[model samples]
Target: MSTDTPPPLPRQPAAEAARATEPASPGIAGVDDTGVPAGGGDAAEVGRGFFRALFDLSFRTFITRRLAAVFYVVGLMAIGIAFVVYLVTGIVEGVGALWFNPGAGISLIVATVILVPLFAFLAVIALRFVIEAVVALIAIAENTERTAANTRR
Candidate 1:
C-alpha cells in the first residue's frame, strides 16, 4: 500500500463560494420578498412585514382553523343554552300549548322553539364538516406536492 495520502481536493475561494451560494442581491429587492434591509428600523416596513406574515398561506390557515374551532365550541354551547331555555319555557307555558293553543301564535312559538334546536344542531354539524373538508383538501395538496417531488427526483 502507498504510504502517502491522496492530495487534498482543490478548494474554492471563500468569496467565490459565497457568490455561488447566495443570490446577487444581499437584501430584499422589493415588497414581494418582505424582508427589511439590514439594520432597517422603519416602522412602516415592520408593519408591512407583519401584515405579510398574517397573509401568508400557512398563517392564514392556522388562524382559520383556530377561529373555526372557537366558533364551533361557542356555537355548541349557545345551542345547549338555547335548548335549556326552550325546555324551561315549554314547561312554564305548559306542554299542552306546544300541541294545542287557543290562538295560532302560541302554537307557532312552540314549534319555533322546538325547531330552533334542530337547526342549530344541523349548523354545528355543517361547520364541523366544513372544517374537516378544509383539512382534507390541504392534506391532499401536500400529498400531491410530495408525489410530484418524488417523481421529479
Candidate 2:
C-alpha cells in the first residue's frame, strides 16, 4: 500500500476551542460575558444592584466592584485636600522662617516646594495601587465563584 497521510482536521475557532477545552463557565451570577454585572452599567440597574447586594443577607453578591469608582474618587479628593493643607502650611512656615535666617528659610522653602508635591504624587500613586488591589481581589472572587458554578453542575 502507498504511504499517505490524511488532511489535518479543521481548526476550531479560538472561542470554541476555549469552550471545548474548559468547563462552560456560565460566569458569576448576574454577570455578563465580560464578567461585569449583567445590567451593563446602566445607572438605574447599577444603583439597584448596589443596594440589593448591600442588604443581601445570604451574601451571594458583592457591591464593592460597583462602588470602586466612587471610592477612588473619594480617595483622590481626600488626598487632594490633604495635599492642599500641607502645601499651605509649608509655605506659611517657610515664609515665617524668612525673618530669622534667610539662607535656611530659602532652603526650607525650596525643599517644601519640591518634596511636598513629590509626596502628594506618591500618595496619589499609593491610593491608586490600593484601589487596584481591591478590584483585583474582587475579580479573583468572581473567577472563583464562576469556577464553582461550573463545577456544581
Best-fitting candidate, scored by lDDT: 2
Candidate 2 structure, TM-score to reference: 0.73
> Candidate 1, which segments miss by more than 4 Å at Cα?
1-53, 57-68, 74-101
- Residue-wise C-alpha lDDT for candidate 1, range 46-107, written one tens digit per residue: 66766675789764223343245566687678777877787666555655564566455476
Cα error of candidate 2 at position 134, Å: 0.8
Best by TM-score: 2
Steric clash pairs (candidate 2): none
Clashing pairs in 1: none
Models 1 onward score TM values of 0.42, 0.73
lDDT of 2 by residue, 1-153 (tens): 776998777688788888787755665467665356667668898688778889999988877777778898998899889888888888888889999988878888898899989998998899889988988898899779878998995
